[model samples]
Target chain A: MDLWVTEYQTPSLGFSCKISETLRVEQTKYQHLAVVNTDQFGKMLLLDGMIQTTEVDEFVYHEMITMVAINSHPNPKNVLIIGGGDGGTLREVVHHPLVENGTLVEIDDRVIQASKDFFPQLSLSFNNPKANVIVDDGIKFVKQHKDKFDVVIIDSTEPVGPAIQLFSKEFYTDVYNCLKADGIIIAQSESPFFNKDVIKMAYSGINNVFNTTKLYLASIPTYPSGLWSFTIGSKKHDPEKVVFSGDLDLKYYTSAIHQAAFMLPNFVKNIIT
Target chain B: MDLWVTEYQTPSLGFSCKISETLRVEQTKYQHLAVVNTDQFGKMLLLDGMIQTTEVDEFVYHEMITMVAINSHPNPKNVLIIGGGDGGTLREVVHHPLVENGTLVEIDDRVIQASKDFFPQLSLSFNNPKANVIVDDGIKFVKQHKDKFDVVIIDSTEPVGPAIQLFSKEFYTDVYNCLKADGIIIAQSESPFFNKDVIKMAYSGINNVFNTTKLYLASIPTYPSGLWSFTIGSKKHDPEKVVFSGDLDLKYYTSAIHQAAFMLPNFVKNIIT
Candidate 1:
């Protein structure tokens, strides 16, 4: 018997992975979550039938999402991650010695529990002293904390269900208020190829709230399109200009890559601008 | 009735598209060819159960493959494209004002026929006065020509069947002899994620024959990984430096993108070096 887990990236397009076993599947309070062991991508996580991450390519998504925001800030001491229940973004945040505290607010406790059980490589950071894992709505958490964080990384899923509010202009305004004077917020904007509307929506919302807004790209194979975009809304610092010079042992993010990521292709520029 | 076409990118992974109709399917002399009209990606061409190009996303692959080499050369007048039967690369090549003549050598004539029948946007280049379309083995054609071309673009499918020799060192050595002193060669090296060994092989072979060899990346969604790699082997000019200042109204490639594409992430750099 052959078992394959397929994510309908669109109604017309699907990405399937052959799975050796379905490790876990449960309908949480928020969404449907599943953990499966795959032959090609190792262990995989799915939420609402969409691929959240795989053990093989999580480094690219995690490093690109967190390090770009973390390194762009001048002195990123306090960091807040919204919806990174898997703990991959938190792992990257805590890796920076300058990041004194990293707080993650995820609404789904079941995702955190599943990651803790099946994805130890990512969930290991949950035990770190610098990492504070919280189970609550991200919007509420950001609204309560004012001028506290140097960087806020929105590691939410697509703009659907629980994530619909996360992509709105009002949510960005709240995030902007939650940041310090020179705070930077980086959100995983969807693929420029597949989700132009979502990218435009996120960019427009973020641009309206922040002093400077820029869109960058990274290649995450498991995403809807392998090409994923991240929108950075900065208060003072320019993400194109690297403020932090220190280096970390990383798989994807480099000074060159940091600069290159901001160089948007002409077509992608058209979508956001 | 639901009609979907899925390309098993690996035994463990598959990418599928819902098709309104299978426009064309035939066992060519070289390989099996199918043109699918997809709801999401428009018309897509598949060869031997692999995606060759799509109407919506072909611009990214065609522009990146041709413009980088054409603009990098001091004067790219005579160009040769091996295995680009779809005429997309030829279209980009002929668009450049500097290119006096563009020759496309495709082993299979049926791909050209299908493209002409179903993909007029790409196949329109076949009628250009500057385009010289030839149906022949690219390897043999390269062996016969000497010091004739300014740029050679290898727009081949994966390293299998008829394209196996296209990735060989001996073939690249022949291509080197076929180019003028300052000529450049750009080949679509497979994805760094899915085809690491192919990338390593192509890079090693090209590096051995060229004075300056560099690997670049572009996001091509229909391909295995949404991220695709292109390898450039130049005899005298560095691909990083743009020599042609004249701009075509292009969607993907730009002067900044030319330099930015060469910026490989550390993990990809690790694969080549």
Candidate 2:
């Protein structure tokens, strides 16, 4: 294969970067991150050997997983974000001032360290007073806690590798037990654009326990197919009509965006429903 | 090279289509039409070799471009859409009964034919009596017509290949000349993340012609970066304070999103200012 590396310069970011035939590497202090130019997804963002997000875009995946279920429950005082080492979901959650406390349950401290070193903007959310960092396995930590969190955001990596247990039915049940009544649970199931079979299985598994199950989209440039979906499950609150009183002054999240986020495209609406 | 394809099955469509790579050839409709997989963009809807919107999601991009700008303009009377061959923008535009006559000028006849054949949902808009379709060069069309349109939306593709001319400084001046005193123009500039240089050039070029210029963003999965920016140029109205009055009962476009769309990310905000 021809190694075609072209450096793209952003006016805001002074230095020019590269887009190779195999990988578009952005050199940072932590590691050499790769963005692949795929035939399907225009570009896919990768770190080390793991998929961070794909070309099709995964902001929907990060946003919906963090926002929909968590926002569904009224007055979410204390919050927990598990395994979202990248801090994208944490960035979305910290926007809500009502979120008095937000604890991140991440096993690999390296992920957070790498993100902070490379992606500073996304990692900035961790500096908030509401954030409490706990570098531990999400499964082990949730089992010990008893109804302490009003909402739990499972921003896990994927079903493969160390994140295998995160996709299991047991994880959903444990997450259900960890939240208070009228609480919500949102998990970053794999990309619905590429991993629908796994996404459907996870959707059904979560649906069995919760009264409300819904899927929504966000476009992330580094995700597969530029289309990413997140499934939300709730015990008490209806996922559709939740009174969002608190405003985070988000660039993406809004009352209209909240409602529109649930309005799945006909393609996604068909598969899971 | 290792070829991978992924599929996002739509039960509603009753066809489990091959979306991105990770999956091989799913099915072929005709001699020229074959559904191929991709690694980056999940499943893509391709005809011959060109890309239509993927089966998974198209609404996000279409809605973001149309609603945000359309809603920002106070009373969209006479509208002109340049290079929107897919008819998605026209579909969204016809939704507003306030629009007197909606004109669409697309240079590529193939895109129009492909969209009409494959995307019936989007093609349905052209049937409206309010819409007038013309096959001509958009830049030249704007140059010929002076001061006729109220809202001009340049919904063209990337600034490569045939779209190079669309990004030129001369074309923007033509757009300015084509709009009425209070009329505004919104063009989908490149991404803030990857294509910031192009974005700055576009902004600077548009600024040279129009007095009021504002750069806004939307999350588009198909674009290079999940971060996509749209530059709006106006003659009389302030891009910051353009009051929108149209109520189309849209899912994505609302008063809140109208404001949020204008909020540039901190990284993007730093450079342009």
Candidate 3:
């Protein structure tokens, strides 16, 4: 018998990977979580039937979402990540030697526990001295904290249930308030090919709250449409013009890629503007 | 009952699309060809069970493959396309006012007939005065004509069956001799994620023949990895530095995109290097 795990990207589209074994499956407080070992992608993490990360292609998403914002900021000493309980985003954040503090706020502790159990490559960062792992609602946490972080990364899932508020303009306003004068916020905007409405909402929400807003793209094979987008909202810094001179060992994020990611295709650009 | 067309990208991975109807299916002299009207991607053309192009995202592949080579050369008048039986590449070639002659050499006549019967949006370019559609072996055609064309596009299917020779070094050397002194050649070099060996082979083959060779990327969701790569071999001009000033009504290719497409992520760059 053949075992395959399929993610229905749309009602008419699906992507599947052959699985070797089911590592773990549980109903978390927020969503359905599953960890599976696949023949092609190695260990995979899924939430609410959506792929969150895979061993083969996790670098593209983690590096792109975190490094672009971290490198763009001049002095990114303090960072806050929301909803990335898998610890991939936090792993990328702590790579920079200049970063003194990295805090991750996730609503569910079950995701963190699963990552610790199955995805040790990513969850190992939780033991770092600079890392601060918190179990709390990201929205409520942002409301209480004001002007503390140099970079705020909204690493939430799709804007369906728990993440609906994360894509709203009101939530962006709170995130903007929780950042320093020259802070930068980066969020995982959905695929431009599949989620035009979500992209437009995220871009517009960021645009309304920040002085400079930019949208960039990366190709994550496990994600919907294989093309994923990131939206950056900066209070003062321009991500495109920032000079990143760091020599962090990376597989996907580079200085050239940093600038190139912001150069959207005509159809993708039309989605936001 | 529901019907789905699945492309087994790898032995362990698959991408599927819901099909409304099977418009045509035939075993051509060279390969098996099929045209299906998909609910997500509109009409899709498949050769030997691999997607060649789809109506919804065809512009991304067609524009990226042809425009980069045409714009790189200072004066591209005569252009040759190999194995693009679907006529999408020809449509993009004819869009440029500078392309006085666009000759397409496809191995199978059945593909052209199928395109004309079903995908009229792409096959309509065959009627243009500048288009010279010929059903011939591209390898034979290139050997017969030396120093004839300004741009040569190898838009063949995956490196399999009849298209296998298209990725060989000897074939690239022959193509090198078929071009003018200031000529450029572009070929659809498979996915960086899935076809690393193929990318290396195509890149090294082109590099051996041309003074300058570069690999670039685009996202075609219907393709194997959603991230697709194209290899360019230039004699005298660098594609990255090309200033495309034409106002061709394109959906994907732009001057900014022309430069940005060449910016490969570190992992993809490591493949060819």
Candidate 4:
């Protein structure tokens, strides 16, 4: 018998992985969550039938989301992560020695509980002395805080269910208010091949809210198309020109990769704007 | 009531596309061939249950394989493409204004016929006045002709069945002998994520015979990991230093991208060597 869990990346496309065992499954207040052990990718996490993160290639997504923004700012002291219950974004955020404090805002506590139980390697960052985890909606939390964060990272899921409001101009405007001057924000844009319209909307929406906006790319094999895009909105600094001064011994993020990620393919460039 | 064609990218991973219809399927003299019309990706061709090329993303593969070499060589008059039965490589090769003649040696005529019938956009270049289509084993064709070509492009399938010999050191040695002095050669090295061993072997094998060998990357949505790598073995010209001179209106490759393709992520750089 074959035990395979498949995600319909689109109505006409599917990506599957052979699972060794079903570790856990339950319906949280937000969405349906599942954690499974796979043959190739170790532990896997899924929400609403969409892959959220996997143990193997999760570093690529996490590094691109956090380190790029952390390195973009001259002195990143306070960092906020929105909707990253797996704690992977926080794990990458704390890598910068200049970060004095980090906060994570995730509405679903069950996801945090499940990840803490299943993915210890990623969830261990929650116990860091400088880290704070909160159970609240990200938009509401950001609206209450003004000029508090040096960098704000949105590590949410695809824009279908709870994440739909997160991609709007109002939400980005709120995030723009919560960040200090010269602060930068990075959000996960969907795949350009499978989610062209969403990516375009993201590109347009971010550009309207921030003074300087740029888009970058990374490869996440467990995602819809294995090609994922990220959008960065900066208030004053340009991510492309920011020099790297951090001493994070990273495995994926490099000074060259930071510049290379923003160089879009022509097909993607046509769709992104 | 629904039929889907799936490629087991590995023993534990599968990527599937919904097919409107199966246009044709046959066991040719070389390998199994199947052409299906996909809902989103248009037409896709498969060999031995692995995706050889898709109508949508074939341009990215073909352009990177040929234009990079054509632009690398200062003056490329004679070119050879091995095992590119679909003529997509030849299609991109003929775009160069400097090419005087091009030859495509394929072991199987059925794949060419199928491409001509199904993928007219890709196979139309077979009728170019400058192209010579020959159905023969490419290894023997290269061995018999030495110091005969300016650039050699190996556009074969993965290392399996009849095409496995094309990845050997002996094959690279023969290809080295068949090129003009200061000639260049490029071949498809599989994904660094899934086919790490194969890419490592190709890198070491090519470096042993050529003075400057480099590996580059592109994102193809239909492939195993969407991240694909290519190996270039040059006699004297460093592909990195050689600037792109062509003026073709391509949708993916750019002058900056030509240099940026070689700027790999740290993980892939570690794997290629």
Candidate 5:
């Protein structure tokens, strides 16, 4: 009667939730996938023994990742999401009336299939007529497209497994070329508390290819260190200077929170800047 | 050879750390206490199956609790900490050049004993000549003192068992009366993400007593939701408007973060306000 599912956030730190039953499990070509019904978090999607999304706190991660860049662009029409297999980022993107077209490139097909089966609320956007879903490598896809997207959002996992190349300078340069002259990109950099080196690497890598770059903080409890960071790189648009007055009917993101997220703590400031 | 220690952040959600060994376990008169050697968090202290402090992220909790109020008051010579049995707040207060004296009144001597024995870095200020360490009930102690201290900090546990009275409206009034005419009080308000009702209770209780009350946030991974909040009540000083230009050789607190901490997201703003 006491069934628990655990994610080892670090080599030693583990987070467990009580589970009513395991919904599905499969071995994808790229990673292992599992879906479970948890007593606390509702439903959870895990990839390779790590928490990818939870029903309870996924709103915080999805909203923070999509809205900041979408709202910052003056006219966000063409939006691109890289490696968001769960479709949460795409779900938030298609909410914008101005986003006429949105595309998602996820390498793992099983991750998407699992989400579509178990997380219908998040996978709603996959059926939108304005959306295009691709099962391909994001690094190669971005390199082939030039000056296409107004906003590029990377919703990849930790810099491990098949997604390791997404953090490279070369891949960022490709993303820079794939965006419009005034486009913006937001990638989930790891935590400053647990992954200082990854934060430094992502900031430094994105800084080399963009005209303007900024790093922001958000609290995502399911992640390794609940304190998570994101790097925003823009060709011309300054995310910190942009403002939004329209109603997005959001649960977390706001114009005030957009500015406040950039104000990092002293130790985190030392790492990025 | 798999050993696990679990802390139920809520009744349904659990956080576990792989343990190499359990250092100490004993039942105090007030609550149960345990010290464990965790692979991820180094040494950790637990009270009544809840995490009190961990060596890895204790800096975030201690620094946020002590430095904000100390720097806000122009001349913080005298300070009082209620229920900080671990001496972490006392240690941070002693770092200020303007703090001439500090007092800590903790209910259980056993918690202090556990801290001194396991958490030496945090318990470094127990023997400070300017500090007065009293083992007594904090609610009774504050009621007997009037216009005595420049700052009063309540670092008690959650509103359970003996500490439930500390979060009541009557107790906050006593804390207000214990301070000087232009004094400030800061209490560890629970997370708005998980403990919404508790946060509401603490915020509304403090708001009734102080002319200016503000809520701020910090990220401590071991705590529930990883997004922890604090409420500050002041007679005249606005915690939002205070300026600090000195260096405390701190790892976390800065003037920029001091400002950002008060900038709540729209959802949290709706809750506290």
Candidate 6:
């Protein structure tokens, strides 16, 4: 089939690149990796049927996922990240003033190593002394820990292969157990477009345990759909209340955007509802 | 050569999809127009080498671009859109209660016709009686008109091709002339990641013509970097003061986001400074 590509830029998608040639694909222990350079977004990397990163914009995703959950929790003392081996999430999490301790539990040691070697800016979050890099299964770690975290951020890959367990009800239940009473958790639920069923399932699963469940949206160029959704589960504090009250120093998430992010499109809303 | 795809979710980039397909040569017009159906974003369309849209997530882009610019302008009586023939911008433009006349100047009638046929929800904006669809070059139209618009939104394609003139100094000057003293113009710049140079250039270009120039960011899934940037140029109004005081109820843009949208990143700040 002669496939034609079209890029929607109304809202102004950041990086738009069209690839014209075969670059290179590297099969990693965790996922198959591929590298392609396009005319728009620059160098992009794909892993195990999912996009990992490109040389273009990387700040939006990392900031929203970390800031929303961290900022929502008034006192984020200890932070646990599940499967953010890229360290980008960790980097943003450490920026929070209240976060004293941060732990990244990733299943693939290679992902972390690869990110550190290749994408240095993303891996920069690990430079902080408080960030504890744990090369262990995030699910296993969550099972052992109980009420130890004030905030938990799930930066898992797609709901396939090793990352599939992160979307399970049992895992989220454990995640609920692993947080403090007033804790908050943000999970990178797949693109609201392609992964509607998965997002709905995850939201339903997380909603079963949490007091409040909110879905936030972000646009990632590398993802299957430009529109990406993140589900934030809070226990005590409401997302609406954790307003952007501080110095107002943010590139992505502002008080207005925080509220807007919660406003899901009708289709996504229908799926989750 | 073998091509590899990788997706990265950055702070500026909400999400990205990388494709690593083997290729022989790159086409000029459709370098980014490779369509791929994935487990996530549905039938993805690429053009000239960037993501256009899938059946999903088009609302996010439309809502964001139109809402922000429309809400920013106070009492937008006569609105002028430079590009955006798909009618997504027009749809959002006419939503303003005070918007008495809305004119869309698009070079590609095909895009408008195609969108009206393929994406009905987006094209619905043009169906309104208030909308005046002008199938002509936006650059020439703006140049011919003087002090004719309250708000001018440049929803053109990328800075390349037919839309390239919209980003030039002369076009911005014409846009400045076409608006009233208190007029506002919002232009879609490139991603801050890959298109920072272009964004910087456009920033400098717009700033040359308008007094109060602000660079804001948005996330759309179908774009290259997923981290979209919009530059707003005002003759007299401050974008920070731009609010949704109008009676039109909006799903996205709000007073808070309007103020927050002007908050520039350190990198962006460095360039503007």
Clashes of each: 0, 37, 0, 0, 0, 73
Go through the candidates in order and give each one's C-alpha lDDT: 0.93, 0.67, 0.92, 0.89, 0.89, 0.71
- Candidate 5 clash pair list: none
Worst ten in a row by lDDT for model 1 chain A: A240-249
**Tens-digit lDDT string for candidate 3 (A1-273):** 999999999999989999999999999889999999999899999999999999999999999999888888989999999989999999988878889999999999999999999998899899899999999999999999999999999999999987999999889999999999999999999999999999999999999999999999999999998999999999988888745685877999889999999998999989988
CA displacement after TM-score superposition, residue A68 of candidate 1 (Å): 1.0
Clash pairs, model 1 backbone: none
Please write out the lDDT profile of model 4 over residues A1-273, one tens digit for every residue: 999999999999999999999999999899999999989788999999988998998889998898888887888899999999999988888767888899999999999998899998789899898899999999999999999998999999989887999999999999999999988989999998889888887889989999998888888878876789999999998888655665677778887888888888889888965
Instruction: Please identify which of the two predictions, 1 or 2, would achieve the higher lDDT against the true structure.
Output: 1
DockQ of each: 0.90, 0.12, 0.88, 0.81, 0.75, 0.18
All-Cα superposition RMSD per candidate: 0.8, 9.6, 0.8, 1.1, 1.7, 7.0
> Given the true complex, what DockQ would model 6 score?
0.18
Worst 10 residues of 2 chain A by lDDT: A8-17
Pairs that clash in candidate 3: none
Q: Pick the candidate with the highest lDDT.
A: 1
Query: Which regions in candidate 3 have their CA more than 4 angstroms from the true location?
Result: none
For candidate 5, give the lDDT of residue A174.
92
Off by over 4 Å in 6: A1-47, A53-60, A90-100, A112-135, A238-273, B1-62, B107-128, B135-137, B240-271
iRMS of every model, one decimal? 0.6, 12.9, 0.7, 1.0, 1.2, 8.0
TM-score of 2: 0.62
Give the winner by DockQ.
1
Q: Which is the winner by DockQ between candidate 1 and candidate 4?
A: 1
Poorest stretch of ten by lDDT in candidate 3 chain B:
B241-250
**Candidate 2 local lDDT, A1-273, one digit each (tens):** 433222211111111112334534555444455655544334445654455753333454555566666566778888888877777778777767677888888777666765675565568888888788888778999999988888888776556655677767888888888888777887766555557776787788889887788776665544444446677788888876757776655444555566755655344555687
Ordered by DockQ, highest first, the candidates read: 1, 3, 4, 5, 6, 2
Error of 4 at B106 (Å): 0.8
User: What is candidate 6's lDDT per residue for A73-155, written digit by digit as tens?
Assistant: 77889999998788888988787777899999988777777677667778887879888999998899999999999999999
Task: Flag regions of model 1 displaced more than 4 Å.
Answer: none
